[model samples]
Target: MRHRKAGNKLGRNHSHRRALLRNLVTSVVIEDRVETTVAKAKAVRPLVEKMITLGKRGDIHSRRQAAAFLQTPESVSRLFATVAPRYGDRQGGYLRIVRTGFRQGDGGEKAMIELLGAEQELGAKQQKRAEAKAKKREELERQLAEQGGNEEGGSEENA
Candidate 1:
């Protein structure tokens, strides 16, 4: 007789479930996107929306409420400062979930939950990461080339 029972338990007790959701919401707020299990993403969706709604409020009370729920002060600040401002003039539906694939270990269905209208920020972040990786790769290759040249020269001198 599971009647009127709302929200998935996610196989955890109340305290654990609450903690998990809080962490997930905080991560989504700070990172703008998070890849997690589909069920978790779905469960955390409404909570994230609520946080954003509070952020939209942009008041002292709402800020306190958000700070109480979210894990870090930085996330609360970012939510109010950046995320909320970005969603101003929009009605709702601040986030979107896209099914990515199954996880390798347990085959759990995975999804990416992202804030709407964050493509530009995400793109820029990705570009920066790619550039850093390329720079590191180039540096490593140069070091390898120098080492190889030194080795060959040393061998010629020995001969």
Candidate 2:
């Protein structure tokens, strides 16, 4: 029986695995959303959270640590300036993973990992805008129908 293994190996050596995790974490911080295999997404979630936790500290050591892991100055800056602020009052759970079903090429399980608060707020705003647009379209159609009916009545009276 398998016992005491902490993480998914993804069939890579230690250095490669570390590099892969750092890249994944960096991309997640930069894009704020990523589509990836479910296993990798799950594995990278905690690493990204730790980076955000460090960013939240907003200290010199944390910045250096983040820079070392991220390997990009811009990404580190974004992590501290944009990402960390969003999670200010919250304690943990900085991400949300949604299963996106199977991938076509290899049939691997796919998922979308997104920073939680921003996506949810954006979704709400989009939904509201969509609803308003639909309502406006319906009102226009009603007015058009009313005008059409009036035109028809006038035509009949003229005939």
Candidate 3:
């Protein structure tokens, strides 16, 4: 019987499957990348590419259609304002899925689905995070040093 069927059901009914795909598409648009199981990454790739195509159209009608399908208005806006423009000269193949090995719990294969040409943005974000972490570490060390100094001074006074 299962002759002409396409697209995996992902073990959910129609509504839940639609919702899950919408949320995944929204996350990919907003964050430029998402780490998920291979099956989900494969399932979401086409929808993300379709949204990017709509964004490239740059019309109100296309925007409305994308907004209706995507999970959030912010995703729609990002898709139009930032994500779409990056592919102005490109044709298709907007997304890429890279295998990242298997998950620990269920042994499902893991993959990272990301928009092409997003590496620079992701790198900048990573740099900012590293800088923030370094700053926090320094602050914590200063606080510990101050506490140690205070404790030594207090002990001396007690003596």
TM-score: which candidate is best?
3
The digit string of per-residue lDDT tens for model 2 on 51-151 reads: 99999999999999999899689999999998999989999999999999999998999999989877775577689999999999999999999999999
Per-residue CA lDDT of model 1 for 1-87, tens digit only, reads 889999999999999999999999999999999999999999999999999999999999999999999999999999999999998
Which of the predicted structures, 2 or 3, would earn the higher lDDT when compared with the native? 3
Of 1 and 2, the candidate ahead on lDDT is 1
Candidates ranked by TM-score, best first? 3, 1, 2
Q: What are the TM-scores, per candidate, against the unseen true structure?
A: 0.93, 0.73, 0.96
Q: How close is candidate 1 to the true structure, as a TM-score?
A: 0.93
lDDT of 3 by residue, 1-159 (tens): 789989999999999999999999999999998999898999998899999999999999999999899978888899999999999999999999999999999899999999999999999999999999999999999999999999999999999
The per-residue C-alpha lDDT of model 2 at residue 21 equals 90
* Residue 99 alpha-carbon offset, candidate 3, angstroms: 0.7
Candidate 3 lDDT score at position 85: 96
Q: Which candidate is the best by lDDT?
A: 1
lDDT of 1 at 67: 97
Off by over 4 Å in 2: 1-4, 120-159
The CA root-mean-square deviation of candidate 3, after full C-alpha superposition on the true structure, stands at: 1.0
Cα RMSDs, all models: 1.3, 7.0, 1.0
